[model samples]
Target: MSGHLDYEINKELGECYLFMGELDKAEQYYTKAASSNGVHADPYLGLAAIAIHRGELEGALNMYQKAHKVDPTDKTHAGIALVLMEQGRGADAFGHFVEALKVNPENMVALFSLVRLGHELNRLDEVVPHLSRYLEIDPGKSEVRYSLAGCLVCLERKDEARAELNRVLEGNPDFEPAKELLAQL
Candidate 1:
């Protein structure tokens, strides 16, 4: 088989092992994949996941950086942002999450994390636009809409919050959180 083909096979095996929670086997296949193609990013991303599973935050960050250097995909940016969040670097993570969203606006993980970090760090203004964008994409996601409502409440936009909460309640009448929030308004 060609080197690229070998890399693909090994990378697939690595992903399977990772999904099965066999970190050692996953690392071995990922290493083989990396050896097959020194420039491929997928193997490095797999390795980064293994490092994270092992609680080696620094190693995971390094591996994520290597993957980003090879190919700056939304997944790589999200991975880097997750590591940064684990390290309590919320501001840095926020930027990376934003970049990830820019690459793929429908990235749910980045969207949720950005909203969460924004709340934790009191950067609610930065979060509103993203939340609005997410709501535009997935209007039926009542939980997310409820979160947006909470953010609007924090910003003292009571009317907007009420509208969002109403939307959430309309979608899922049994959503107690939205109902409670609406009651507050």
Candidate 2:
């Protein structure tokens, strides 16, 4: 069989096994795919996920880094950031998350992780523009707007926070948190 065909078959098998939670089988196929000279990062990404599931933080980080080096896609950046976060390196993860967001502003995982990290790092002010950008594309997301409101409140920008809460309440009148937050404002 051609190398490309072998890689595709192996990578597909790896994905299928990974989806079925057969980590050992998945790793075998992923390894085969990675060594087939296909120059693809899916195999390494699959390996990274397996390592993460097995509580192998260092291995996961290494695999994610390899995948990023192969192809620095938003997913690869997110993967690297997740491994860094798991290793208790929030400071290092922040930049990777930012890079992921830069590549795809609508990447929910990176956006939410960055928001959480911002709050943890006491950098709520820096998270506003990203939230705003997301909201611009999706206005009816009450949870996201609520999160933005919370950030604004922490930044002492009460007026803007109140406006955001009001918008959330407008979208879903039964949203108790928004109502409660607006009342507090």
Lowest-sum lDDT 10-residue window in model 2? 119-128
* Most TM-score-accurate candidate: 2
lDDT of 1 by residue, 1-185 (tens): 78888888999999999999999999999999988855899999999999999999999999999999999999999999999999999999999999998898778899899989988999999989888887788889988898899999999999999999888888899999998888877
TM-score of each: 0.95, 0.96
Q: What residue runs in model 1 are displaced by over 4 Å at the alpha carbon?
A: none
Per-candidate local distance difference test: 0.92, 0.92
TM-score of 2: 0.96
Q: Compose the digit string of candidate 2's lDDT tens values, residues 68-98.
A: 9999988999999988888789989998988
Give the local distance difference test score of model 2.
0.92
